[model samples]
Target chain A: GAGVSQSPRYKVAKRGQDVALRCDPISGHVSLFWYQQALGQGPEFLTYFQNEAQLDKSGLPSDRFFAERPEGSVSTLKIQRTQQEDSAVYLCASKLKAPGQGRNEQYFGPGTRLTVT
Target chain B: AQSVSQHNHHVILSEAASLELGCNYSYGGTVNLFWYVQYPGQHLQLLLKYFSGDPLVKGIKGFEAEFIKSKFSFNLRKPSVQWSDTAEYFCAVIRRHSGGGADGLTFGKGTHLIIQP
Candidate 1:
């Protein structure tokens, strides 16, 4: 089966430009998450979705970050204005269902490397 | 806020050498611990998890980790490593959400392991 996948394996943008990153979760996964990984560092949580509802956005850094999953399967993380600090690998992960159901493993995508110059 | 720590930023070893990677987290509440691995050009994959029951958890490809509450550690170990084991390893933690839904994970800086043949 196809796992979670992100679009545009690599993206380069000017510092003030806006960018939208897409994620396609596993076919039946109900939980999806986004993370950011800086060079030589680990990934940091960004946001989470349970179906179409944006359950958690606490991890989002600022107002510049917005995410939506209108159809409950495909998601998009939009940055209003790209910043040099935003240059990193953006990762997407999906799980089969809600947690505490005796199964809670997230499958990750190859991630999209975003570079803001 | 919860935070994960991976002491070793990089480790180099020869094939067949024993391997141990240190991981520690700080959170006063109950949490789920996880280990993820990313090979070159590949997405992050689950190595193992420790949710409940036995403290010692085993993962895929001859890997195991021990969760020690007292030390706040979950170090990964392999009796003998292969060159194929060379990759970046991450330690993550998820705080048990009271809402009965999934939560975002806090990850460490990650450890880059290089194995020579």
Candidate 2:
């Protein structure tokens, strides 16, 4: 794919239901990121991955929110017992890693809009 | 923790109007700054970024941003805006030395720009 891709463009789940969002990052992208964007707000970091390593999960809101990139190519963000407050757009981004470089430009996906009813 | 602030929640202007959007960060150390634009029903797209050197950085769509270390600000500007430029703008930053473990961005509450014809 030329850009990051996310599945289930829109999801509506009843409160307490579990929902899973998927993200497929650009091929060979070494860094993947997840973010949550509430209505009228900017996207907030949720977690980060360097290949298959879950190097950072501090941004996950709670224990119920989990993310994994097992094979380093695709990632999934699962929310258990979804609450109304969980209704927001989930964004996925990826970046190529440059040796010795501290940063690189990130490419973003269309995002999946989740609505907890 | 680093935090970003975008002062304008909403801005309205007519076509060909000069445009400026303010963004400030609270980080004290070296940081990378970025501006992203999200059009209606479209994915987020990078407008520009500031990594090092020249304080002024140019991006796609004739947009540019200036990084002022003294003010901890990276403000976006354009000489003239068209109706097609109406979109939500976000400012983001990442600590330079955070390494691969903490590569996610901290974003500000977005500014909504409306350019009327």
Candidate 3:
């Protein structure tokens, strides 16, 4: 793909429902990141992956949020028991290589706008 | 935890006017800074980044940012503005030696810039 691609550009879910958002990073990107952006706010880091390993999950808001980038190509962010507070835009981004080689311009996807009622 | 702050929540400018956006970060050690813009109905795109070397960094669309170590600031500027420059701008920073484990970025609340033609 030319850029990062996210599935279900918009999702409407009822409270307590479980929703999954998928992200397909650029073909050869080695670093993948997930972020949550609320209305009128900047994207906040959610989780990070280096290849197939989940190196950082400290930013995940709660137990309901889980992200996996198994196999190092595609990633999925799953939210269980979605609440109204969970409504936000979920963004996925990728970088060409590891974190700090002095090259860290992450390319972002259009993002998935999730609405929990 | 490193954090970013963007002071101006909204800015309005006319075409040909100069533009400036302020961004500050909180971190004791070396850090990587970046500016990203999100045009209406589009994904976020990197504007510029400062990892090392010169403090002045130029980016696409005639945008540039200067990193000031003492001020802990990386402010974006454009000598002239256009209607197309209207967008939401974000500032991000990552701890320099946090290892790949904390590779994810900490972003500011964002600033909305409106350029009228």
Candidate 2 chain A: 10-residue stretch with minimal lDDT = A95-104
Clash pairs, candidate 2, are none
Ranking of models by DockQ: 3, 1, 2
Candidate structures ordered by TM-score, highest first: 3, 1, 2
Stretches off by above 4 angstroms in model 1 are: B96-102
Which is the better candidate, 1 or 2, if ranked by DockQ? 1
lDDT of 2 at B52: 92
The local lDDT score (0 to 100) that residue B20 gets in candidate 1 is 94
Best by DockQ: 3
Q: Which candidate would rank higher by lDDT, 1 or 2?
A: 2
Model 1 per-residue lDDT tens digits across residues B1-117: 678989999999999999999999998667799999999989999999999889999999999999999999999999999999999999999844556545778899999999999
What ranges in model 2 sit over 4 Å off?
A98-103, B95-101
- lDDT for model 2: 0.92
Superposition error at B45 for model 3 (Å)? 0.4
Candidate 2 per-residue lDDT, tens place, B1-117, comes to: 789999999999999999999999998877789999999999999999998999999999999999999999999999999999999999999733355424788999999999999
Pairs that clash in candidate 1: none
lDDT of 3 by residue, B20-62 (tens): 8999998867778889899999999988888889999999999
Q: Give lDDT tens digits, candidate 1, residues A1-117.
A: 588889989999999999999999999998899999999999998988989999888888999999999999999999988999999999999988866665578899999999999
Q: Report the C-alpha lDDT of model 3 over A6-95, residue by residue, as the tens digit.
A: 999999999999999999999888999999999999898898899999888888999999999889999999999999999999999998
